[model samples]
Target: MAILKLSAAERRRISAFFTCLVLALVAWVITVLSSSYNYTVKEIITFKNAPLKRAFHSLQSDTVNITVKGTGWQMLLSKIREANHQIKIDLSPLDYEDFVVVSSQLPAINAEKAIHNQIIAITPDTLYFDFTNRSVRRVPVRLIKSIKYMPQFTQSGLSIIKPAYVTISGPSNLIDKIDVWHTDSLVLKNINEDVTTALNLRVPAEGNISVYPKTVQVTIPVEEYTEKTLELPVKLIGNVDYYNVKLFPQKVKVTFTTSLNRYADIDEELFEAQADLNLWRTYGISTLPVKVVRMPAFCKLVSVEPGNVDFIVKR
Candidate 1:
C-alpha cells in the first residue's frame, strides 16, 4: 500500500468541527447544573373550631421552607410565588388531641433537583369551644298589649287575674346568679271600662338565655262602673310619703243606690279610691287626676251622677 499525506485544509476543518461540538456540550452541562425546578407538597391541617379554619387553610408560615434543584433554564422558568403555591390538607381527618394543632404531614414540593430535596414545614393554630347544660329558673312576665282609659278618669290600680312567672333554661354558669327577670313596662293610658287583655313576656336587657314554653297566658282585669249615689268620705291608707302623693279631695261624696247585700262590701278603701298624685307631684304637676275614691270591696261604683268633685289644694 502506498502511504499518502493528508492535506492541511482537510485536517484544519476536522479539528474545528470537533472543537465546536465540545463547546456546545460544555454549555449544556452548565445550564443543567445552574437551573431549578418546582416540587409539590400536601399536608394535613386542623383548627380547634369552625371559625379558625381559614387561618391555616393556606400554607402561610415562614417556618415552612421549600427548596428544589434542576437545570438552570428550568429553574428560571419555574416560580415559587407564595400566593400561587398551595398545599392540600384535610381537617376532618383530625382526632381530638390538643388545643394547639400540628400538621399531619409536611408540605410536599412539586420542585426537583432530580434527587432528594426539601419541601416545606407547616405549622397550624387551633381553637376551642365549651358546651354545658343549665337548670330552669323563674322570670317576670311583661305585657305587650296597649290600653286606653276614659277621658275624665284613669286606672287607679292594675289587677291581675293570675300571677305572672315564667320558666327559663340556659348555660349553668349564667343561670346561677339570676333570680327573676323583670318586664319592661305596662302603660294603660285612658281606659275606663272592664277590659280583658293578654300580655307578652320579655327577657331582661342584654341577656343570653333560653326560655322554656316560649309563650304564656296573660290576663289583665278591667272594669268601669258609675259611682254610688250615697256620699262616702274618702279615707287614705298605706304610707303616702313614699309616693309623695297629696290627696286633694281629702274626702269624696260617693252616692250609690244598691241592694243592702250589694252595698254590704262597699267602702272607700275597697274601691282603691284615692288620687295617685304622688308621681305627678314629683315632676311638679299640680292638676289632680280623677280616680275612684275609697269604697266597700263588694260594692261596685254604679253611677256617681256628678262623678268627680272639685277640690282646693295648697301644695
Candidate 2:
C-alpha cells in the first residue's frame, strides 16, 4: 500500500486557502452583529412603593408594547435576557381621586451597562390608573370540604378551621360588598380517620382586592358509631272530627346508628312517628302509612317497625 503525502509548497497553499476562508467567516459575523435593527418587545409593568393608605382600583394596562432600535447583537442579547425586564412605577406620591399617566422608564442592561438601545415608540405612550382610599375589613373564612366516611364510622362533631377569619384590604367600594371568603375545595373519600390539612384560600378574580393569610388549616373529626334501638309512641295528626280513631300497636321500634359519644344523648323524645288522619278521611282507607317526622341530625334512622298501621274509626 502507498500513502500520498503533500509536498511543502502544496501544504502552504492549502493552509493559506483555509485561513482566508476563516477570515472571511469572521468578517461576515462582525458585519452582521454591528448592523442596527429594530425590534418590538412586550414588557410587564408593575407598581412599586405604593402608598399605604391608597389603593389602585383600575389600571388601563399591565403591559407595554415597546419598539426599540439597537445593534443586531444588542437586540439578540435583549431578547435572550428579556425575562428580567420589568418597568416599575412608584405610587407613593399619589392620593385618592388622583389619576397618573405613566410613561416608559427603561431599565439598564446587564445591571451595569446603560442600554444603548433607543426606545423608538411605546404603543401606550401614556398609561392611566385610578386610585381610591384603601379600606380594611375582617371577613369570615368558610371551608369548602366534602368528606365521605367508611361504613361504621361517621363525623362526630362540627369540622373546625384554624384562623376562621381573614383580613382583606382594597378599595372601599369593593371591600364593602365582600362578606365572606372561601377556601379551595378539598375532597376526601373513605376517610375513617380524623383529617387535618392546610388548604389554600380562594383569591378573588378581581384584581382590586387582596386577602391576607392565603391559607388555613382544616380538621374534620371522625368517630366509630354504634347502633341503638328505642320504642317511640305513635301519634295521630290532623283533626279526627266527630270520629274517634284508634290505631293498633301505637308504638314503633326506632333503630338508629350514632357515634359512640352521642349514644347516651339519644332518646325517644328526639324522634316522632305519626300517622296522618286526613288521608284516611279523604280516601276512606283503613290502613295508613306511619312517617318519622323528626330525628336527631347525627343519627341515621335505620328502620321503623310496622311501616303501616290498621286504624278503626267510630262515630
Candidate 3:
C-alpha cells in the first residue's frame, strides 16, 4: 500500500507505460482478426478451344459459386468483382489430368454475409462442345427453275441433263456429308411445240453449305410433233436502216419430231425469217437477200440451201 502511492512524475510515467502496452495489445488483436477468415473454395470449370462464333454463345449463364475462407470481416470484404477481385478462373491453359481443384488466392472482395466463407460447389451445364471450322469453298451450282404445270398435267413428259453432278469443296466435315445436291424443277403447259427453259440450283435441306459460283446453265428438253406445213412468223429483230427494206418468205415448210402428243394444240405461227434487200442495194451488190422467204415455226432452221439470191434493181 505504501509503494502504490507515488510522486506526480512517477504516476505520469506509469500511466504512459500502461497506455503503450494497451495500444500494442490492440494492434496485435487487429492483425490476428484480419488474418483469420472463412472462405469458400468452389468447383473447377473446364473450357475448350472452340470456334469464336460458338464460344460467344456459351457465357449466358449467371451466378457461379466459388469457395473462400477468411475472417467474417475479411470474407465479407471479398467480392466477385473488387478492384482486386477475381470473378472467374480459366482452365484453358491446363492440360487434361485427374486432380482435385484448389482455391486460388484472389484480391479482396465484399461478399454477402449469406456467403460466409464456406466451401462451395460449382458446375457447368454443358460439356463436350463441338468446334466448327468455317471456310469458304467453290461449289458447282446448277440452275433449277421452278415451273408451273397446266392443270391435270402430271409431268407427262420430262427430260433432264445426263450426269447431273457438280464438284463442290468446303469444310471437310460439312462437305464430306453431301453426296448429291438437287435443283428445283421445270414445269410446262399443254399445246407446246418445243420450248427451251432454264433451271436453278439449290442446296439440300440437311446442309448449310454455300456455293462459290452461284449459277450454272441448264437446258430443258423440248418435245416436238410432226407437221406437214407450218407458217413461219416473221421476226423483226434489229431496227432496219432508213433506206433498207426487208422481205420475208411469207411461208415456211415445218417438220417436227414424230410425236402425236407433241404436235397437238401447238402454236407454230410465231417464227419468221426475212432477207433484207435494202442492204444489197446500198452496197450496189447484184446477189443479195437471196434467203428463203419463210420456214415452218416448229422446224429449227438447219441450213438455208441457197441463203442468198441475186436481186438487181437500178439505183
Q: How do the residues 50-92 of candidate 1 rate in per-residue lDDT, one tens digit apiece?
A: 2222212223432333344344544444454332444443343
Best by TM-score: 2
Please estimate how well model 1 matches the true structure, expressed as its whole-model Cα lDDT: 0.46
Candidate 3, superposed: residue stretches over 4 Å from native: 1-228, 231-259, 277-306, 309-315
Total backbone clashes of model 3? Answer: 36
lDDT of 3 by residue, 32-67 (tens): 777765455433332333232221212323334554
**Candidate 3: C-alpha lDDT:** 0.44
- Which has the higher lDDT value, candidate number 2 or candidate number 3? 2
Order by TM-score, highest first: 2, 1, 3
Models, CA RMSD each: 19.4, 5.4, 23.4
What TM-score should be assigned to candidate 1? 0.32
lDDT for model 2, please: 0.79
TM-score of each: 0.32, 0.70, 0.28
Superposed on all Cα atoms, model 2 deviates from the true structure by an RMSD in Å of 5.4
